[model samples]
Structure formats: C-alpha cells, structure tokens
Target: METILNVEGMTCGHCKAAVESAAKEVSGVTDAAVNLELGNVIVTHDDALNIGEVKQSIEDQGYDVK
Candidate 1:
C-alpha cells in the first residue's frame, strides 16, 4: 500500500532528508520520498504498516503531518 501525507514546515534539503529518514524507519515501510515543493511525503509500505505510526514518525522529526 501507498500513503501520501501532507506535511508542513519542510523548506530545504535537510527537512526533506529528515522526513524521509523518519518515515523509512517505520516498520513495514519499503520506501519513503518527500517532495518539499509539494509539502507531501509519499510512503510505500505493506499492509502491516500503520498510518498513524508513519505520521507520528514524521511528527517526531519536527514536521507536522496533516
């Protein structure tokens, strides 16, 4: 499954990397890509992945997931 999360406060390369890293660390996530320009994170994962977990992971990185 794929999940797209609308995020806020990502303004540069560091933000992009941080969000991607956080998302990828979640169990069952296969890949995570962030589009700073679009303020979104596209996450690819299996059914076992919890959407709330990914959101909280990004939130822990200091970004707000909408």
Candidate 2:
C-alpha cells in the first residue's frame, strides 16, 4: 500500500531526511520519501502498517502531518 501525507514545517534537506527516517522506522513500511518542495511524504508499506502510527512518527520528528 502507499500513503501520501502532507507535512508542514519542512524547509530543508535536514527536515526531509528527518521525516523520511521517522517514517521508515515504522513497522511494515518498505520505503519512505519526502519532497520538501511539495511538503509531501510518500510512504510505501504493507497492509499491516498503521496510518496513525506513521503520522505519529512524523509528528515525533517535530513536524505536523496532515
């Protein structure tokens, strides 16, 4: 499955890396990519992955996930 989340407060490469790292750490996630220019996070995972957990992971990195 794939999930696209709009994240706020990402303004640089570091923010992109942080968000990607957090998202990748979630169980069942296969890959994660962040587009700072678009404020979007694309997550590829299995059905077992919890969307709420993914959002929380990004939030833990100090960003707002919508």
Report how far residue 35 has shifted in candidate 1, in Å: 0.7
- lDDT of each candidate versus the true structure: 0.94, 0.94
**Model 1, range 1-66, lDDT digits (tens) per residue?**
898999999999999999999999999999999998899999999998889999999999899999
* Candidate 2 global lDDT: 0.94
What's the TM for model 2? 0.96
The C-alpha RMSD in Å for every predicted model, in order, reads 0.6, 0.6
Worst 10 residues of 2 by lDDT: 29-38
Model 1 has a clash total of 0
Q: Estimate each model's TM-score.
A: 0.96, 0.96
Mind giving the per-residue lDDT tens digits that candidate 2 earns over 1-66? 899999999999999999999999999999999988889999999998889999999999999998
